[model samples]
Target: MTDPMQDPGFLQDPYPTYAAMRSRCPVQPVSTGSGGHISYLVTGYAEARQALGDARLSKDTAAFFAGKESRRRLHPAVAHTMLATDPPQHTRLRKLVTKAFTTGAVAELRPFITQVTDELLDQWPVGEPFDLVARLAVPLPVIVICELLGVPEGDRPDVRRWSAELFAAGKPDVIDTASHSLADYMTGLITAKRLDPGGSLLDRLIAARDGDDHLSEEELVSLAVLLLVAGHETTTNFLGNAALALLQRPAELDHLRKNPDEVPAALDELLRFDSPVSTATFRFTTEAVTLGDTDIPAGVPVLVALGAANRDPERFPSPDLLDVDRDAAAHLSFGHGIHRCVGAPLAKAEAEISLRAVLARFPGIRLATPPDRLDWRRTRLVRGLASLPVLT
Candidate 1:
């Protein structure tokens, strides 16, 4: 009955609101300030998974915006990426990049990830306070992604700036400027790769474009930008949020420290408890569909509340408690069905390595400030902390 968005407790901790929604209305209607109305917020575990995998719920924004005034507002490149596609096109694009994210690829990068983590940790000043979010969380992922993509190390700072701007581009003015700037930058990179192909993902994509004719230049640039942004930003939030959660809940941190084997399981629980990406990317209905008791008509814009679904009491016992050993994989943190995240393995590895390394190295790590004093990101899409000052 309560508006989850306007609830203060929901803003701080949404588990209560999630439980209420799951019981009262699995599919409830809500409005967006843009004058569009979303017919339902799918909060239950099974239903959220079903909707994510369903073909009837389209990821293609163009289909939803077709013949609508909003069609003219979206950037063309945004609609072309794999995130906005469904079926054969999504499958095709995913195949072109799947090898880069396979378990073997991530396994090979473990040593490199460890090295990066150690190098950053080695630089941390002793005794005094330091901001973990900026010094470590932000740069580690950016550096790893740059290396993976063969992006020049010297260009990392600029790349990070561009990535942050792109993530913050939810505003109209910011979106327009950031989109144009990123497009121009990517165009130059793609051109260089075409001339001097090398061993990076971008180079592989260029080779694919030239040899197989399966990929286009525009698509290559779009994919490159997507990898750069998604690869770094989401992981940054994951590591940052997980660290903050552990600091807030010392018992869970101790449990992880004692049972090093539970790192993977703990990571899953952390994701479920406080997801990095609070909402699904975006979905538009292909045709009028019935979800629970709600009838969502075609062309309606819908965003799945992944954070809410993860804490649904009906799905997991004691969903609000942080249980490191719980079978938390059922949580929709990586989503489900066809639209499941392709970079999940890599992200999981990164989180496990990062958390383990931090706990091992800084056993005395604790929040330098009170939990409530810590700043959180204002956006609903990416749940992150502004800064996490910790004492090693």
Candidate 2:
């Protein structure tokens, strides 16, 4: 009967609740409060991984709601994106987008990422308290993604605003507004790219060809919208959470400062220690599936709690502790299986550059206010601080 999404305390620090659930009801039913919608929450590491990779669990909302009353509730633009599709559709959409984030492409972006990180740090108010979320975490990814996608600098603020509003839980109207507005903007942007290709990824997507198969107009807009939303938001949260994690553990912070070479490894531990994505997107069972001791009926929605799985004792020793030296590469932060995040490489590069720059710039930086006084975002989909006030 417990609803973690409705509990402010759970939203602030869900680890305790996740630990309790993993030990007690590993696959428990809970309500998300979206028009009385309910879902089975998978908390244990094995169960979560199994559920995520299960082919019986459908990602297409339209397939689940084919003739249901909720069929019309979702816009085509929102429901038909690569994230919401499986198999052939997801394959096609992802193929067009994957090359841009391949190792080579992402490597090319390091210089740009470093330049932007340094530029943002240079603008940071020195010797005075400043909100790291606003000054550093928020702008770095936004700038990088915008530049990568060939989006005009002037339009990024609106994209950021709309993306933030879309993820705001309980604001269905705001979500709807942002969804349609961003879709429209992406549609126009794709059109602009078509007319005058900027040689950016967006242009590549527009020109992508595979054996006479090309992205349809709707697919192009949806893919653009997806990249815009996912590319920046995850990295923004990762950077903010990484900074907060390091700041809270002084010895670990000093260890990392002394061993600057370990920043790359530290990023993996930071991601596992406090995942930015609390849960995977919605998945529904196409047939009865037993997860742990719980029976999940066909057509029932399931959410894989990434935060819980990352800290599950069976998967991680001293699950709650942040050990930068741990071989944390196997963590499920970027997720596992087919739907794993495509832009993870870019996110890691951005975080590594940003974290190193921040530490080097402010060797004596520490939280300006007590840790407990900091505000965490209330949204259930993403875990991040609203503001991280720090002083050097």
Candidate 3:
């Protein structure tokens, strides 16, 4: 009878609710608030992973939204990118876009990421309390993504604003307005890239063709916008979530500082400990799918709660505990299968460099307030602190 998705308590601490749900069944029908829509929520680790990679659970947004009243008002560019399509189109888009996030390409950005992390860390006054989310977490990814995409420095502020508004939970009007604004901005930037190519990734995307198949004008715009949106928010939330978790468990933070080389490996544990992406994006059953003995009808909506799967006791022993040394590489924080996050390498690099730099820069940094008093973001998709006030 509990509305696990929308309840205020679940937003603060969903782990208990997830445990309760998983105790009964991995997949269960739950009312998803208005319009009397019942969605199949996947909470078990094995089942969640199974559901994510199953082609039966389609990612086609138009198909998923049909005959349903959705509060999300997304632009075509925002709604119909690689994240919201099936094979063929999705494969082509993923192939073209994966060029920017290759291993060598992301490795090349470490110096810049470290430099930016240090520069941002330097802004914090010694022995003074400051909001880490605003000062570091939020701006780092925005700046990094903009620099990669050739966005003007002056225009980044507006880009940040628009990107944030895209997640305006209940305000469909605000979400739609932000969606168009961001799409329009990207459209103009793409036109500019065509006229005058630059050294950034955006320039390459504009000119590159995939086996005589270049992105159509719409696909190009959508891909560009997708890169920006995808590159920005998730990393921002991950950074914030990772930092907060480390601060709470000083032992784990010390482990990274002492063994800096292991920071990269330790990132997966942090990602699993407090997953940033609460749930994977919208997916509906293309045909009847059976997950963990639960039978889902064709065309029914399904949700994979990444946060729950990461913390499931079956997949991870002592799931609630934060152990940096644990091999948490298999976590579904970046998703799985063909739809695995294209920017996973870049995101991992960002977290590693940022964590190493920040920990090194501010050794004495600690939370400015009690852990319980910290403000967590009250949204379904992203799980992060609104503002992590810390003292240097």
Candidate 4:
């Protein structure tokens, strides 16, 4: 078997490697410096879904390590968020977020989302080439998250900069520094919110904290930073990746244009065809668990390949092909069961509105550079282009 990371072809198009892995070794041993030598990387659809939802596979790395000396070596702050925890803590954290994602909640934000999309399109310079990532993908989510989190409009630029630093891919030192910076910033923001409560997610969280004894000041700040960063970064990748998919497949773009009603379905296909999140949030086995034929022992870190599982041919025929009409709702792009993304609905709504607005405004939009020449994020868990150049 080949190292997926070393293969440029695999980096550009991982489905082939995923297909091979799924067939040959659904449960493969993978090594990560943080978790040490571990049997990880679950590829098959059923196995991936089961692993994501399985109670036996603990999301809490701290609890998994307990009194072990190795545990202290890892970054405790990054590994202690909702993404890294199980119920009832996960459940409690998710509840505070779920309110912001209710159907009524998202519907109310639709007009705002549309407005943001239109404003971005209106500002795009015509004729000369521009980086869609800078103009649209990055700004759209940044603005939305700022509004949602009650981050003052003045601080958006700094917030975005901090988020980029925190999520800097593959760079351990940068990640560590960024994590501390974000924590410090959020601590200050939470303090401000406490002094002057405004009607925003932060204010709501502060109010909710007053009622629930479980949510500490530190936890609230940590979760706020998590939501703000994850909320924007993941969706930025989705918008960029979805646009790339449509530009690559003009027919699909045309199909979407003709049937605006297909936006929801197409979004699902876009997610599965080129999922924003390349891998699941890391999970460690609580005990020896058998996935397919491989045996993974306790304390091993596992990454469920959401991207790979979404492209499994056994689940979706011609899985590699982007078919807007395909029933892609079953894809694990938002993940499965307990740890599924809480902001999926909002993310989907934002993507649909943003994509439609971009295509409608810039009908001639296409990749300005060869797809092969496009750079990708190196250290981040997201699978996305570094910049998507386009001629509007």
User: Per-residue lDDT for 1-392 in model 2, tens only?
Assistant: 55776666786689998898788878899876656677899888889888888888889976877777642344578767799898978887887889889879999999999999889888888789999999999999999999999999999999999989878877777888888889989888887776777888788777763235566778877888889889999999999999988899989999988888899988888999899999898789999999988999998999899999999989899999988888888888898888999999999999999898877878999999998888988787789888999998
Model 3: per-residue Cα lDDT over 131-177, one tens digit each? 98999888989999999999999999999998888776667788799
Which ranges of candidate 2 are over 4 A from the true structure? 71-74, 209-211
lDDT of 1 by residue, 51-83 (tens): 887789988876766676652333456546789
- Quote the positional error of residue 247 for candidate 2 in Å: 0.3
TM-score ranking of the models = 2, 3, 4, 1
Per-model root-mean-square deviation over C-alphas: 2.0, 1.6, 1.7, 2.0
Q: lDDT tens string, model 4, 1-392?
A: 33465566766777888888888878797665544544488788888888988888988866766776741222345558888888988888888888898878989999999999898888888888899999989999999988999888888898888778765655667777777777777788888988988999888888877775567876787789888988888899899999999999999998887778778778999999988888887788888898877788887788888899898888889988999989899999899997888889889989989887776767788888999888777642678777899887
Q: By lDDT, is 1 or 3 better?
A: 3
- Model 3, residue 118: distance off in Å is 1.5
Misplaced by over 4 Å in model 4 are: 1-3, 34-36, 65-77
What residue pairs clash in candidate 2, if any at all? none
Q: If the candidates were sorted by their lDDT against the true structure, best first, what order would they fall in?
A: 3, 2, 4, 1
Q: Scored by CA lDDT, what does every candidate get?
A: 0.80, 0.86, 0.87, 0.82
